[model samples]
Target: MLTILPPSFTLTDDSLQELLLSSSSSSKSWSAREEACYLIFFSGTLPVLPGSHTASIAGQKEEEEEEEEEAQGDPLSESQLTSLKEGLWCPDCRAALLAVLSIFSPGSLAATTASSTSTSTSTTTGAASAVEARALLLQVSREQWKDRTDGGHVYRKRYDVQSVPTVLKWIGGKEVGRLVDEECADVDKIRALVQG
Candidate 1:
């Protein structure tokens, strides 16, 4: 099976671009495709919305609402207030990280063959998805594509990325595909974009 290692983290687009450029042969952009492709991803997220209860139990949704009201009735604890002030509740962002990590959880890239084949042409959609998550590491220059909170980040402004858990696929130093916000939470979608 062909597999790529997970991405390596970088703080700047120039540094990341440089790493991707040199990632393969000085001549290649580093991809499973004959042409070489690279990926940059961002997983940072803002806090959840006020009306969130996406996972609230059916019967307990009302109870939770009541609890929220009750909690408001009481004075807020210092820690509770602090948590409210600084907490980030974006489960999708966490899920995105977990989905990718889950692909790696079974085994490290070092445990696999150094070189292999790509899954972009697998038999079934499901099979292709399963393999591509791992293929993501091998198919592209393995620079970790995580997001940053710096509003002034280079690519952040350039790409106009407004959500967390974003993924960008680049070939020849140009972006070819992207997944923003919750889309990045699905390993299948992530792999599809990279593998596509």
Candidate 2:
């Protein structure tokens, strides 16, 4: 069994790319331990979407009229909300993976992230819109990706990757160019690695 390790930094396209390149140079495949870590870490950062609820239909005039006639009232239960937050309202791991992979799917990451942010904010006030939520989420996201870097931690670590974008760019080769082009990742370390 492989023990997965958290990324030394955020799992950006650049970092993933760099790992791939390094592995390729070393004659290794994506199945390598570090590569597996990247894959697992990437898989976990995916966003969960809320599902349809009684409140959702309540917003519709037709459903409102129908409900009024029936005197029916059952809002989304707290458990349902919890389940939605888990991204487990339904079991669609493939779809979820696709969503995560969409980060590399030309123009899809921005669109999906935007839509996700908007949806999350719809339940809150204007102060909690996608624009604001993204900023907060991005910050939290970065923190989550941060490795434990106390004094002298860098030398203790064998592979010293610091940023997701940087790693992605280094190992991405040609496939991750979309991420680089989108300005979501960078790859300057390849030169450094080569020079050193």
Candidate 3:
């Protein structure tokens, strides 16, 4: 609906450029090229349609009936969807997830359990939080990626991100501060500088 609508809800190129400029004002860690790619894929004009109560009244009534029918039938579980949404909405969480996705595959994470004795390089290294974060990354779907794009956000594409340093550079190190705790990482210092 938003895609077909006029430039009201979607971001314009000028607005996206301004957003990038403002973001770059903080640190030189983000990749302008990557950001550009993100904008090209997701940015668009907003919807110009006006709301009409009468026009929507019949649709709402039909939707309510459908909802009631769905409620009577087997309802879809939303826990996974909710978790994915939270992870995408939270910058720090998404950054951390990107780092994890860089290292491990979803099948590997799902196959291993607390009781599993098959130890791997990813499972053996770093903090448990890091491991768990990676596990969560495997659970995120492409639909969530679309949602992030709709939110005017960019994510570190697993294949595009070559290494940790590259990922750091891609998002601009300044934004990296959001991923770590104040005590754990120098987020304040990162925020003080602009990135190219």
Candidate 4:
């Protein structure tokens, strides 16, 4: 069974301390051997989208409000909405991550497992089984770029990640593949890398 370690930021201070202690001690609780496949997402490269803003014109406030309401009533196209969500980035790394998660999340895996078992006498193939196995997903914050020595520094150094939006694939603690920056924006490419 593969054990996916949650991101450090998500853990409480006590849990983090315990995790650190366990990691540092000779008897490692979370071994790479246990979870052969892992995916690390360096999220620093992706630009943060600005919060929604409201502007008021001194004289034309009512007219501007009416226009704004009309504009809001007309929904944006899928591509336009995606572009707006992605902000300055050409490709949406966050969207790509969400896509990957949708496919490989625990819920999806459970569904796959149930379906495979319920089907006729066909046994699960190695590739399919591997796909069914949940891969560890870790998100490294963009703030890590500011302090190179902290916040996933070990992984950053090990993977030779120079920028954000880098997705590194590891099997048995060894890096098997990587997709950097805009390259990681493709869901098909990510699926191929993970399955490959």
lDDT of 4 at 4: 28
* Model 3 lDDT at residue 98: 21
lDDT of 3 at 42: 16
Top-TM-score structure, candidate number: 4
Stretches off by above 4 angstroms in model 4 are 1-36, 44-92, 106-130, 148-152
TM-score of each: 0.43, 0.22, 0.20, 0.44
Top lDDT model: 4
Question: Model 3 reaches what TM-score against the true structure?
Answer: 0.20
lDDT-sorted candidate list, best first: 4, 1, 2, 3
Model 1: residues with Cα > 4 Å off, grouped in runs = 1-13, 28-38, 43-90, 102-152
- Check candidate 2 and list the clashing pairs: 13-168, 14-167, 14-168, 14-169, 15-167, 15-168, 17-171, 17-172, 18-170, 18-171
The digit string of per-residue lDDT tens for model 1 on 24-50 reads 345543442344343334333222212
How would you encode candidate 2's per-residue C-alpha lDDT over 97-195 as one tens digit per residue?
222222222122233342443322222222212121000011113334443756323312323423332222222222131121112211122212222
Per-residue lDDT tens digits for candidate 4, residues 39-93, read 4454422211111111332465586456545544322334543453364232345
Candidate 4, run of 10 with poorest lDDT: 45-54
TM-score for candidate 4, please give it. 0.44
Pairwise lDDT winner, candidates 1 and 4:
4
